[model samples]
Target: CSNKSGNKILYLHFDSLIIFHSITTISKVSVTAGKSVSIPCLYDSRYMNYVKYLCEGYYWNYCNYVVKTNKPDRSGKYSISDDKNQKIFTVTINQLTNKNTDYWCVVEINGGSDHGESFQLSVSSGKNSGGMKWCRLGRNCVTKSSGSIDGTTVTIHTTELNVFTVTMSGLKPEDSGWYWYIQIPVHLTVTEKLINSKYCKRS
Candidate 1:
């Protein structure tokens, strides 16, 4: 969870069962800006009795970096609450930013090495405000393209060209991904329809 490398191993032992700690459950992996979200995590049933020993390490402002201990405080704009004895840890973050942040839960077995699990908090906004705006070359087109929607929108700017607006409306569960684009324009003046979606891209 904390380590994006995903190369680490965590093990726990309880009641001579040699229980290895693992993440049993998780909540939504991503969320929208200014929206409330929860991260639910659980441990292996064998280690349920020791659930009280679990603690959460939340990345308050950066990517996968823990900024505070397990307690509600003003130190950062976030809160952590859960029933450790029930093996349920819920981390509620407040006022997410454009930056990426992640959270992890760890438990150190008494007199044993610590084992942990983590989840990512995907933060997004209704509409991506920064990106290339496009339109087609035409006069009869609605002639509107200055606002933002939660989903994709296309506009005609030139009679021979096409325009597009990208957005993520009504935020859904399957909209998570890193989108890419490659363009090769055709006819100098053509009747065409364009569609676009807001997304994160890697160069």
Candidate 2:
């Protein structure tokens, strides 16, 4: 899972206790709507025996667990496993859809607050899983290399099981096209609406 391109970014600071450090995870994980993904959560070597779980929710403060390493078979769509040797646990979710986007990797700290790191699991709906490409002025185009996207400052990352994140910044009218897993296209008529979710509002 660590062997990905420059698209993923690690969060140095998380919303937890001063002593409770969260696990290391991919900055952005992208996957197809129907594809499956295994999310890796790295923890402190001292807490190898601590319980690990995968939770899902729009709000980080009230995340609902989908699976745990202690109870792997409790959920049919989700399961978790821990490897003390690696000091990391993996959470696997099958048959993913748009609803299976936001998630958190949590560790139950002893006699203190729990540690966790949030991730954005963007489940895109695309049939073409090719490398990124860029088009200028809806004309000439070029094949893009990883971590070298043009205009939109795009970053595409992939881990074991094809999970990735398509993060695009600096949107422009000309920066429109089908750029592999992550695409940014301009719409003729744009109608904006205020989102009620905190995540969306922050975005």
Candidate 3:
């Protein structure tokens, strides 16, 4: 089961009468193409001395290493720093592109199971004049022209500065997951109401 508290997410798993808790700082992030973003990963105090790293992939077991606290990338595309006093580590990715999709903040365990939390990254060109589409992952996208989908209504408005604001109405509890704005994948949590929305840019 998963529970969200503020910007942190707690995931629980049970195996062999043991319980595991995985907490993540953020679930999703979006950046303009060619831009950079810094993601923060918070961990338990017990992992303060452990190795922390950022890996990229949709699956945890097969994610490719992007950067680590001990091994920083020489190419300068990625870097990680751990703040032992704060129990948090931050990963910075530069010159992001659309290909940067899923990633994980992982805490390494020497002789036991590792702990991790996954987050999705979305990149947009900000040069598409055709406006944008709001989509649920694996489902059809809803455009301003289309107006609605599956009992939900999505309205998009563009400003003179090319900034796009998307409003989603009639959200249910099941709508609480990943959604995309123009190619930007963002996580939205719906409880008594919609909790998050993204302001997209298109030129």
RMSD of 2: 19.5
Candidate 1 steric clashes: 18
Each candidate's lDDT (Cα)? Answer: 0.41, 0.61, 0.72
Quick one: ranking by TM-score, best first?
Answer: 3, 2, 1
| Candidate 2 lDDT trough over 10 residues, lowest sum | 1-10
Q: On a 0 to 1 TM-score scale, where does candidate 2 land against the true structure?
A: 0.54
Model 3 TM-score relative to the real fold: 0.54
Residue 200 accuracy (lDDT) in model 2: 61
* Residue 176 local lDDT, model 2: 36
Q: What is the lDDT of residue 8 in candidate 3?
A: 38
* lDDT (tens digit, per residue) of candidate 2 on 103-130: 8888875555566777777778875354
Stronger candidate by TM-score (1 vs 2): 2
Candidate that scores best on lDDT: 3
